[model samples]
Each structure stands twice: as structure tokens, then as C-alpha cells.
Target chain A: DVKVTQSSRYLVKRTGEKVFLECVQDMDHENMFWYRQDPGLGLRLIYFSYDVKMKEKGDIPEGYSVSREKKERFSLILESASTNQTSMYLCASIPSGLVTTYIYFGEGSWLTVV
Target chain B: AQSVAQPEDQVNVAEGNPLTVKCTYSVSGNPYLFWYVQYPNRGLQFLLKYITGDNLVKGSYGFEAEFNKSQTSFHLKKPSALVSDSALYFCAVRPQSGGYNKLIFGAGTRLAVHP
Candidate 1:
């Protein structure tokens, strides 16, 4: 079974603080993603990494950045955390060249920016 | 770009009754449709997906979804609702072409199974 683990499950930070949400996958998938979940907005992609050192912006990427220094780990960084950034963040991973694409997700990190 | 629409924001059903969550999709080419369920404070779990061949796809937790090409819909269904089945359900789609692996998701539907 594939396992995606998030470093933190809950966090609280003051406004304008730097925050980091880390994720690791045991499957060695080539693609990793970060998403934020909000009521009525569902899950919106924040950033994705296809390979080490390669990143792409998703639907909503403002105030957020990502790092993929290694194949097994992906980190989401908030340059300046704001109250609006408070939400549940999810990390997902998928292997390349699969006939049927399926992305596995971690438990998620709930960030509270006060 | 691929997109999905879950028409209902919420669906209330009684335990033991059949439940259905509606979903529709739009894509430039043939689509790969998927249904996922998210429990409170947890990430989304894969329920099922429709690639090709069978129109009716059965998935985990006794759940299923039907793919209708004409209607451009892939609605998730369950034979009987359980109290534990209540969760947030999301429908997603990706275009078969363009080597696109990113999935566009719906706003999600909250399923409430009353006892």
C-alpha cells in the first residue's frame, strides 16, 4: 500500500509568519501535489512538482511555494502566512506511466494563521 | 482544460436507503473520471474511477459510479447508506489527451446519512 505522510497535523501561526508543511511518500512517485481545502471551495491545487527541482503553479499559488529536493519528500512553504491561509492542506503523490492514474493523499495538515 | 461539477451541495438520506451523489464533467477529449470521499479532518480517499469499457464501475466501501457518455456524467451510487457513509464527496476529471495528469475537482457534496 502507498503511504503519504504529513509532518504536522495541526499548527498555529501568527500573521506574517513563515510556515512550512512537509510531506513524504514511500511510493517514490514522480508527481507530488499540494492542495488547500475550504468549505464551498473544495480542494484547490496550490503547487505541484513533477520531478526534483521542477515545480509548477496550480490554480491558486499566491503566497505559497514548494520544494522537492528529493523524490520522496515534498514541502509546502508559506512565504508570509496570513489569516486567509488558514485551512486544511493536503499532499498527494502518483507514479508516472500508470495506465490508470490514481493519486494517493496524506492525512492533511490543518493550519491556523491567527 | 478538464472540469467537473457536482450539482448538489448536500444530499440527505436515511440509513439503509440507497444513496446517490450526482456528478457531471467537461473535457476537451475523452475523460478519465473519478470519485473520492473525504472524512472529517482527513484527506480524500479514492472510491472509484471510470477509464473505459464498462459504464458502471464498482469501487471500495460498496460504492459505485456510472459513466454516461451522452450525458457527460459520472454519478456515484451506493446500494444502501450507512451512518458511517456520511462524508464529503468529490468528483474529478482529467483529459485523456495532452498527457495531463492533473485532476480538476468539483466543489464537493456533503453526504448526510441520518439514522
Candidate 2:
């Protein structure tokens, strides 16, 4: 079975603070993604990494960055967290670039910015 | 670009009754569709996927989906609903063309099963 683990289940940060959310997948998936899920708006992609050191912006990538230094780990960074950034963040990984591949998700990190 | 739409925001059914969660998608080429379930406060769980071949895809918890090419629909169905079946269901799609393709998700339908 594939397991995608998130470093934190719940986190709190003050406005303008820097925050980091980590995700690791045991399957050695080549594509990793970061997304923020909000009520009504659904899940919006933040960033994605297809390979080490390679990143691409998603639908809503503002104020967020990602790092994939290794095949198993992917990190989402909020350079300056804001109250509006408080949401459930999800990390997902897919084994390859094929569109038929299914993406696996971590439990999720709930960020509260005050 | 690929996209998905779940026409209904919620679908309510009673226990022992069949239920359906509607999903439609738009993609330029062949579509790779999927169904996922999300319990509150938890991440989305993969239920099933339609890559090729069969139109009827059976997944965990007795959930199944039918892929219709003419309607551009991949509707999720279950013979009988259980109370535990209540969850947020999302339908996603990706184009068959290869690349770093992302799965486009629908807003999701909240399924409520009453006993």
C-alpha cells in the first residue's frame, strides 16, 4: 500500500510569519503537488514538482512556494502567511507523468493563521 | 486543459436505497476519470479509476462508476447506501496525453445517507 504522510496535522501561525508544511510519500512518486482546500471553492492547486528542483505554478500559487529536494519529500512554504491563508492543505503524489496515473494524498495539514 | 463538474452539490439517500453522484468532464482527448471519497477532516481516498476498457468500474465499499462517452459523464453508483457511506465525493479527470498532468477535481458532492 502507498502511504503519503504529512508532517503536521494542525498548525498555527501569526500573520506575516513563515510557515512550512512537509509531506513524504513512500512510493517514490515522481510528481508531487500542494493544494489548499476551502469550503465552496474546493481544492485549488498551489504548486507542483515534477522532479527534484523543478516546480510549476498551479491555479492559485500566490504566496506559496514548494521544494522537492528528494524523491520522497515535498515541502510547501508560505513566505508570509496571512489570515486568509488559514485552510486545509493537502499533499499528493503520483508515480509518473501519465494522465492515467492516480494521485495519492496525505491526511492533510490544517493551518490556522491569526 | 482538462476540467470536471459535479452538477449537484449534495445527494441525500436513505439506507438500503441506491444512490448516484453525478460527474461530468471536459477534455480534448481520451479521458482518465476517477472517483474519490473524503471523510470529514481527512484526506481524499481513492475509490476507483477508469483508465480504459470497461465502462463499469467497481471500487471499495461497493461503490461503482459508469463511464459514458456520449454524455461525457462518469456517474458513481451504489446498490445500497449505508450510514457510513456519507462523505464528500469528488470526481476528477485527466487527459490521456502524457506529461506532468494534474487531476482536475469537481467541487464535490456531499452524500448523506440516512437510516
Candidate 3:
């Protein structure tokens, strides 16, 4: 069984604050992704890392950055958190070289920017 | 550009009744379609996927999806509905070209099962 863990389940921050959401996957998958879930918007990708030190922007990457210093850990960073950034963030991973494999996701971190 | 569309915003069904969630997609090349379910305050969980071969693909928790190439649809179905099956469902698509590894998701449909 693959396990994807999010460091924080809930967070609250004031406007213009810097926020970090951490994720770790035990499967050592090569593809890791960050997504935000909002009501009526579903889940939109923020950023994804295909390998260590490699990152790519997703559909909605504005105001957000990601770090993949290690293979097992991926972090999502909000340069300046705003109320619009308040939403549930999810981390996902899939093993490399498998085109048909589905992504495994963490429980998700709920961020509240006030 | 790949995209997925879930037509229904909500679906209500009674326990032991059949349930269906509609989804359609568009992509440049061959498309890999997937269905995911999310409980309240949780991340999306993979339910089923359609890559190739076998238009009807069975998946976890007695869920299945049928891929209709002519219609460009992959609609999820269940024989019988359970109260526990109620959740937010999302349909996603990823192009097989170059293994892009990016999944485009739909707005999602909320399933409500009444006992």
C-alpha cells in the first residue's frame, strides 16, 4: 500500500503571509503534484515535479511555488498568501514509467487565509 | 489541450438503485480517462480509468465506467447505490502523447445516496 502524507491537515494565515504545505510519499514515485480544491472549481493543478530539483507549472500556478529538494518530499509554497488562496491543497504521486498508473493522493491540507 | 466535462452538478438516488455519473472528454491524441471520488475534506481517490481495450472497465468499490469513443464519453456506473457511496466525483483526462503526466479535471459531480 502506498502512503502519501501531508504534514499539516489544517492551517490559518493572515493576508500577505507566507505559507508552506509539506507532502511526503513513501512509494518514491518520480512524479509529484500539487493541486488546490475549491467549491465548484474541482481540483486544479498548482505545480508538479517529475524529478528531484525539477518543477513545472500547472494550470493555476500563480502566487504559488514548489520545492522538490528530495525525491520523497515535495513542498508547496505561497509567496504571499491571500484570501483567494484559501482552499484544500492536495499532493499526489505516481510511479515513473507507468503511463496507465493512477495518482495516489494525500489526505490534503486545508488552508484558510484570512 | 486536454479537458474533461462532468455534465451533472448533483445526482440523487435511493439505496439499492442504480446510479450513473456522466462524463465527456476532449484531447488531441489518445486519451487516458479516469474517475475519482472525494469525501468531505479529503483528497480525490482513484476509482476507475479507461486507457484502451475493453470499453467497460471495472474499478474499486463495485464501480465501473464505460468508454464510448463515438460519443467521447466515459460514464461511471454502479449496480446498486449505497449511502456510503455518496461523495464528490470528478472526471479527468490526460493525453497519452509523450506521457505528459498532467491530468485535466472537470468541475465534478456530487452524489447523494439516501437510505
Q: Which candidate gets the maximum DockQ versus the true structure?
A: 3
The list of candidate 1 runs beyond 4 A from truth reads B99-101
Compute the lDDT of residue A12 as modeled in candidate 3: 96
Query: Would you list the C-alpha lDDT of every candidate in the order shown?
Result: 0.92, 0.90, 0.92
DockQ of each candidate's interface versus the true one?
Answer: 0.75, 0.73, 0.78
lDDT of 3 by residue, B1-115 (tens): 5678888999999999999999998877778999999999888899999989999999999999999998999999999999999999999998887554568889999999999
Stretches of candidate 3 off by over 4 Å are none
Q: For residues B5-112, could you state the per-residue lDDT of candidate 2 as single tens digits?
A: 898999999999999999999888787898999999899999999989999999999999999999999999999999999999999887766455456889989999
- Span of ten consecutive residues with least summed lDDT in model 2 chain A: A94-103
* Residues A1-114, model 3: lDDT tens digits: 999999899999999999999999999899999998888888898899999999999889999999999999999999899999989999999998888879999999999999
What TM-score does model 2 achieve against the real structure? 0.96
How does chain A of every candidate compare to the true chain A by TM-score?
Answer: 0.98, 0.96, 0.98
lDDT tens per residue, model 2, A1-114: 999999899999999999999999998788889988887666888899898889999989989988889999999999999999999999998877456667899999999999
Per-residue lDDT over A1-114 for candidate 1, one digit per residue giving the tens place of the 0 to 100 score: 999999899999999999999999998899999999999888899999999999999989999999999999999999999999999999999988884777899999999999
